[model samples]
Target: MTAHDTATAARVRALVAEELPRLVGIRRDLHMHPEIGYEEYRTSQVVVRELSDAGVAYAAGLAGGTGVLAHLPGEGARAVALRADMDALPIVERSGREWASRTPGRMHACGHDGHTAILIGTARVLARLAAERTLPHPITLVFQPAEEGGGGGKRMVDEGALDGRHFGPPVDRAFALHGWPDLPLGEVGTRRGAMMAASDRFEVHVSGTGAHAAWPHRSADPVVCAAAIVTALQSIVARNVDPLDAAVVSVTVMQAGEAMNVIPDRALLRGTYRSLSEETRSMLERRMTEVAEGVARAHGCTARCECIRGYPVTVNDDGAVAQFEQVARATLGDARVRTIAAPVMGGEDFAFFGPHASACYWALGLARPGIGCPALHAPDFDFADEALPTGVELMCRLALA
Candidate 1:
């Protein structure tokens, strides 16, 4: 590294160290009270209050929901944006930490609390740098809600979160990070293309004549048809898609008769299909519908399928990926920065920003050696406190770089 870069990295580490305690406290507070989707009122309030305290300029009540936008001082025509999701899952908390989820059935199992705190910390550091007039370009902080499944990122874009037409200067580049439970703390992961899959939800409704439990050929059974449909759905991936293509077809939810003796007239099946490429995504949707109807027809039942198009596959800009690698390597030694081996099947709404601006969504390690951390979405999951400073430093350096 050059002498100037080395000095800057040292300076950033010191600043992040100074802010770590307060930021950790804030992160724990958020962990104690978790909110879901657009209901991140308290979380938004905390962000606004912190931003105000940090002397950062911001506007709340954005995105037609619980979203906040903050801007840092700089001198450039182009602006860079950073994102942090502020929502929790509906799982009951099982983590035995002192600052576990206070809200009964909601928890920050995905480490969004840490992400929010890290972004806030980054803002604090950049605000200080802006005071010293070291910022290269204006920075945009996006406190987005409903990233769990409600597509808050898309909502923010729809509400003009990225479009400079209404909010501020048009965002030229964007970035965000998700906590990774498998990797060790103080490490980061990044990839160039298709970092995550496109998630689409589907429902199959099967209808048939009700039949008595004792009767066999007296009436048509929708339960039988639904079971056959579920079994056949698996072939959509194994048989239809190319062997090299990545795809998953899971029938997560199924509903049928309520009584023990009588077969219901209709059955409802719900599940999600994920693919890393758009062609495979389309192929899965079409084949799933065709398979459902075709299988039900063979059983003397009629079936209809409904597919809800969700966020597209998350594709990272090559240039943004290179920049993130440099920033992460400089901020936290080169050994800590890693290129992911494969794309995760999970879904991310950050894909929305890729089309609007250059965007890169990376992962922050939350695990500790020997003391294996709980995987994300697990009830007992908690954000690692020790990783907070690393997250803060990486974000600050990325903004400055």
Candidate 2:
């Protein structure tokens, strides 16, 4: 490694060490009052307060109502954008911690609170660099809201968050990180290609003539048709799609008859579709429609299907991933940065930024020593405080590099 890069990495490590206490406090505060999706009003206010106090130039309410975009200008035109989601999930707190969520039925189970804190820490470090005239390139800090389900990333893009105004000449690279409980503490997991799947929701409505249960011949039971459609839809993944390719078609909700003695006239079924490729998504959609319609026709009923597309596949740029690997190796040594073999089926709205510029997303380990880590979206899930320094250093290095 060059002497300059070594000095820069050492500076980032020192900055992270200095900011660790404040970063932990911010994360705990966010954990105490968790908000869901597009309703991150109070969360956005806290971010604004922190950035304003740091004397960083920023734009509040950039995307819709909850997103905040802050810019730290440097000496060169080459710019980098760093993103952190600012939304919580609807899960009761069960972490048994002193600083657990005070609000009932909402918690930061997905580590978004931690993500936000790390980004804020990065901001503090970069602000210092800017003040000292040591920053090499501009950095864009994106505090995006509604990453849970509101597609706030897309909203920010629509509102010109990534336009050249924020980053000087548009972002040459974008970086983001999620807290991962499965990996060891201070470790980072990344890949060069698809790291997450595309998410899509579908609803099927089955219609038939209603009648009494005693006169079975007279009624075309919609519940029976819905059941058949559900069974057939499962085969689309097993029989139609390639065995080597990954796909998931789950029927999560089923609503039909209310009365015991009468057959319902309509039945509604809803679920989600997950795939790694656009071709797989299209194939699943077509096969699902065919299965619903064919099953209804066979049962003397009519069926209609509606598919709502969600986030797209998260594809990491090869060049950006290489840069991140270099930074990780330099900061944490060679053993901490490793390739992830399996791609997760979960979806992320950060995929929205992939179409605009080079993107690289990685996972920050949060598991505590001798303690079992909790899965995301669970009631007991909590962000580990020990990983705060690691996250802050990673972000600072990515930005300064």
Candidate 3:
């Protein structure tokens, strides 16, 4: 890097250092009082206060729910959207921190608290730049709710969250970030395409005649059929899908008779399937149904399988990936920025934004050396506070870029 780039990074780092403490406090406060998807009234209020205090113009009651939309208007017509998810998970807190979840059976295990705080800090930074007339373009902040499998991102898009109606010209591009437990603190990771997988859920029911244990050929045992079907479903991934591609077919739930000797007339199975490619997703769905039904029919039992589609694969724009690499490397230094080696199987609601605009959802490393961080969604998981400043600086730079 040149002297000018180094100087600019230093200035941004200093600004982030000044605001880090306050942002950490806010993150902890949000962590303490966690709210779940689509029910983020209190979380929305906190976001409004933060944006309002930053002197940014915003519109609340958006997305047909508790989502807030705000923008830092500047002289330039070009615009970009920066999103931060505001909902927590349903898991109870066992992190044992002083700022652990106060709401019973609800916790910010996914580090959304950190994401919200970082965006707030970014808004503050951009607001300062706007006053000085140095801001290159308008920045729209999307404080989205219900990202935890509630289709909140889609709702915001449908409700004109990025329509740029009252904020500015429609957003030309969009960006979001998620905290990653695999990378060490102070580093960031991104990939070109298929950064995350698509999610689809299925429920299978097998029906047969109930009978006593003494009956051999007198009854069709659905319990045996269900067991066989579960084993058969695994072949959809192992045999049907290409070995080069990735897919997951997991049978997570099974229900059958209550008694040991009496065979129940019905048996139920439920699970989720995930894939990065659309063809693979469709293939898995079709094969799973065929396998379940065929296996049951072989056992003289009837089967019904229902599949519900969820989020699509989160694909990153090639141009956006290149732009983000430049911004991240320049702001955080080359040693701190890394390219993601592979796509993760986990699903994200942010996938909805890809079709609407050029989008890239990157990962902020939250783990520490020699002191491993808890994996996301784990009972004892907590957002790493040390990574807050990095997140703030990254978001601020990306918006200006």
Candidate 4:
């Protein structure tokens, strides 16, 4: 390893050792008081206070509200960005822990609380480095809100949070971390490309004539047509798309009749589509619309489908992935940095930053040896405090490198 790598590794270890307790406290506090997307008022305040305590310069209320940007300038022109999402899923805390969520029916089930705390720890370490005049390149700490469902990262981009002043033109590098329950503690997993799938939502409306249940011949049954459309949609991925290309079409919602005997006039079907490629996404959309309309036509009904694109696939740049591997190996040791061979189906808003700059998003392990950790978005899911040092170390290494 080079001298810079050695220094960065040492800094990460030092920061992790110094900030572990503070990181755990912040994580537990955020976990107990969770908030949903676009309503991270308290979350933003905590972040601001922590940054202030660290003596870091920051801009609050970014992207209208609930977004914060803290900057730590370095000696070089090239700058890097470290991002953390700050929105919790609407899940009731079921971990049976003493620090369970205080808010009813809301919890940090997706580990956003941990992500925020780790980034704050990173801000503190980076601030110290800047104060000591040792950083080589500027670092921008992005405390983004609404990574659960809302496209807060995209919104931040639209509001110009990634502008040069925040970092620099075409941010030289960007990185983010997510806690993973499946991976064992003390390890990090990442791949060079397609770390996560693109998420898209679709709603199909089927309209038909309503009539008495006794006279079924006179009425066009939209429910039947909608069911057929749903079945046909499943075939698009299995038959139309290539088997090697990953794609998922799940019909999560179906609504039709209000009464047991009466035939409803309309039926609605809503679901999400996940794919790794643009071609598969487009093909799925086209096929879904065609299948819905064709099935409705066959049943003497009318159908319309609307597809809304969410976050794109999280793709890590080759060089950025290499850099992350180096940093991870140095910070956590070569045995702890695991190379992932396949991509996951989950979606992330961090993918938005990739279009603007070279980005790498990795998963921080949170599973313990004997404890069974709950998966993300589950009501029982909670971030493990032991993972705090690993997360902080990853962010600091990325920033310092």
TM-score of each: 0.96, 0.97, 0.95, 0.96
**lDDT over C-alpha atoms for residue 161 of model 2:** 70
Tens digits of per-residue lDDT for model 2 on 221-290?
9999999999999899999889988999999999999999999899999999999999999999999998
How many clashes (backbone N, Cα, C below 3 Å) per candidate? 0, 0, 0, 0
C-alpha lDDT of all candidate models, in order? 0.89, 0.90, 0.89, 0.87
lDDT (tens digit, per residue) of candidate 1 on 302-335: 9999998887899999999999998887677799
- Candidate 1 ranges beyond 4 A from true positions: 1-6
Instruction: For candidate 3, list the clashing residue pairs, or say none.
Output: none
lDDT of 4 by residue, 67-101 (tens): 99888867677678889999988777788988899
Runs off by more than 4 Å, candidate 3: 1-11
Please give the distance, in angstroms, between residue 97's alpha carbon in candidate 1 and its true position after superposition: 1.3
Better of 1 and 3 by TM-score: 1
Best TM-score among the predictions, by candidate number: 2
> Lowest summed-lDDT stretch of 10 residues in model 2?
160-169
Checking candidate 2 for backbone clashes, the offending pairs are none
Tell me which of candidates 3 and 4 scores higher on TM-score: 4
Candidate 2 positional error at 345, Å? 1.1
lDDT: the better of candidates 3 and 4: 3
